[model samples]
Target: MTRPLTVALVAGGALLARRALRRRIGASPLWPMPALEEPVSGRRRENRRPSSHRVLVAERTEPAEGVVRLRLEGADLPPWEPGAHIDVVLPSGAVRQYSLCGDPDDRGAYTIATRVLEGGRGGSRELRERLHEGTEMEIRGPRNRFPLVAAPSYLFVAGGIGITPLLPMVRAAERAGADWRLMYCGRSRASMPFLDELEQAGADGGRVTVVAEDESGPPGLAFLGGLPAETAVYCCGPEGLMDAVSGALGEARAPHLERFTASAAVPGGAFALELRRSGRVLTVPADRSVLSVVRDELPNVSYSCTQGFCGTCRQRVLEGEIDHRDELLTDAEREDSMLICVSRCRGGRLVLDL
Candidate 1:
């Protein structure tokens, strides 16, 4: 098993708010977006898939305490949907993913935000220190595994920095004239990003519930039971909140949500692992993860968020039927690559590209 992460804040969830509203969704009636694995921009995934592009840190701002918003600018950038995210490759070789929170119509740049977790992983700290206005770095993808779909109505719930992804969705829902509401919760009002914007946007039309644990206890999620199942619920927040909502609504009526952390399942028996590059054979015991065992021999292997939410630990599969356990990878990515931090062999031995 991976070691326990000392995440200080109560924000313990992955960015997993993927609710395909089961119909065509568009910001305006002019552009009718179809509900599919990709956006309705007519850009094919493989044909337009870019390598890495150098982007300048054009702008940076602290929207809230411990949260940084960066505007990475480049020329003729690819278009993205509301829930898309990009992989930021750092100078230190550490890779981190951030949801694109900016306007999708603005194709010249991408905007992303992150919250620094004290005593947690090091990516956010490195990003804050190394990145500055005019600094150039390589970034890949505006990949969308969580694109917004057409729904009769939407209920957006955000926790702390989790609002990054939902911000665009809220805007789209509002602009599209679809029925929607927001429930934004955080440690305090000062800790929540995009608070004023969300409040202003939701002020005249719909409900925008702001629950601060400092003043009010945990907000009651029991109202989910009364809502129509057709109401597409998009939730991105703490793990406990997601669990509470899911438990109350049940799996059949599951709320669409996102996670910032990995959820490890029951480990199977021991298995053999083959590293084709380094020519090393290792045994991954039942209680351990493949990442822990491989790191012993190959100390320089890149890894962050050992929970498997980040794509840093992904490796090519030379051979083996992998028991995939990560939410970071899409169906196409899972065809050959697997996140070593959580995935394991189905049975017997597995071969990797090291």
Candidate 2:
């Protein structure tokens, strides 16, 4: 009886040790995961995915009239750069990307401000009305695609809410003693965010220029001509302003652009997508995004930033000529993968390595 009890205890210990080893390997950053894991019972494992953090909305305040600033607190949160953004997931599962405008050194909390767009989607509206202090929310990413490049001089053009991402860059430039100038434009003083901060930064030196359309006419591109040829111009604003900046610069110099909106739709009618691993096919309409359709079939498919700016929904194109609409991916990344959120198939039928 004693011998049998000892054998049972040994078996239990071995089982626990095996589980601990598996957990350690799974958590290891060095652990290599296949592009597409082996299917279980002919279905891919979706729930066995990387988990996002649950942060406490520690504080909420109105910085501008219609803009709400949120201070999210978390433990051992990931570090982010100036232009990085975090995906704020709503209670209803809606995810919205907001730039991290707070100090990067502060790992305990993340600060993000969003302007309430009445005509736009419900993201900003939800933040304004629903989210509150002490609210627990899941967040993914602090990803950066609009990284500040080293240049002789910097020219930043920010319009209204577009200022969120560029604000950090301006602060970083000042700290590095880099030559940088910011041209901030808005509808009115009451509507613009971070005005006081910008004013404080400008007080010492006249590096910041605030232009309200009510007082002055729309910002003219005359300033563009005065800038040095090697100046790296970064612009984030409405489509019209971006177009004007691009047109003004011409081929002389290329300005780095960050769009708050998605790119123009892919010029195509309806197309069919085949989920190779799942063995399912779905039709995507011209007006509807591929993400919406893909979610209907595979409910657990990973996605964020429906605008195609984030590469979360990037799926391997097994056999399809992609329209490749997103600006986020590089020329090499476009060869095999596509952001299904905004991009579409140029061909009639496409296969995805789900």
Candidate 3:
């Protein structure tokens, strides 16, 4: 039998065995299943969460100009979905986020592409210039907020470095035999990574459009206009490209966007944040972030991404009002809680569960 058929047969047998065992146990008072809960609960209470994995740079290759592909050394790593990002703990103690660009089915190693920004905070530059093979670094998370949802067809639009996360999704869509098309836009052909792979994958009459900005006029909004209503559009790029796409989609189509920028700053005055645990009322400055204010007041508080993408700086809003600016929190999460990283108080005073 086929592998899937074998799996189905085993599952059916297991279900039958479980039903028979349950029937037999229903008549016996000494089955000991429920009695073992006490020990299980005790063990659960004692067990702590696993520590962050320390991954070594097994290999580093330059797939494109100003971009370095890093393969980390970890076989039994935690499972991660497409569009997931990992926080790399740099030597300078700076935590930087990078999208996982490798195949998610390959569990043996985690791969990420890093593009050195011209005015970046030295993380990418260091990775490109200084980091070498066998160098070890502390890695945390394969956290995902921009997950690929089920759609009849997909329209993926990526710009420059934004193609990193979409790479895996495209591979997954191909495996599932889903209808999808990718519009990868970059400055030039030489700057675009995985160009050869993308072209070869689509060589057998697949739909993949590579639009180089330097060689042609801007890809018009008409590109999105042709998409079917049943198709879900996914976009990731600079603010300009995102804005254009968003404008084209409007409220009628509502394309999903993964922002590479900080949340828009709200025009609001400063307010007081009351910590419920400490019974301390702290005044929040107009220019400072809630995470920064909290860190200044309470030095021991831990945080990873101050951009609110990571849930590390999350806090419950017990009372008062809030002006949420973080992209991490869902609409429901914003109603009950807040990400102190980017969110701020709306009214005069805000109460935090802390």
Alpha-carbon lDDT of model 3: 0.73
Clashes of 3: 0
Candidate 2 residue-wise lDDT, 1-354, digit = tens: 000001012344444544543454342221223246344685433312123788999999888889999999999899777777877888867788788899887889999999988998788898888899999999877666677765545788899989998988888766655556788889888989998898788566567777888877688776576565656789998999898888888877788888888877746788888999999998998888888999998889887667876567888887889998885665656777888888898879889888
What lDDT does each candidate get?
0.78, 0.77, 0.73
Task: Tell me, by TM-score, which candidate is best.
Answer: 1
TM-score per candidate, chains pooled: 0.81, 0.78, 0.79
Q: Mind giving the per-residue lDDT tens digits that candidate 3 earns over 1-354?
A: 101101012344444544554554343211222222344443322212123788889999999999899998784788777778887777766667789999776777899997788797677887776668989887777766677776546778889888998888878666655556778788888998998887776555447777787877566665466555666688888889888988887667788788876757776688998889987889888888788888887888777667766556778787888787775654545666877888887789998876
lDDT (Cα, tens digit) per residue for candidate 1, span 171-194: 887776556778888989899999
List the RMSD of every prediction in angstroms: 8.9, 17.4, 10.7
Instruction: Identify the superior model by TM-score, candidate 1 or candidate 3.
Output: 1
> How many backbone clashes are present in model 1?
14
Rank candidates, lDDT, best first.
1, 2, 3
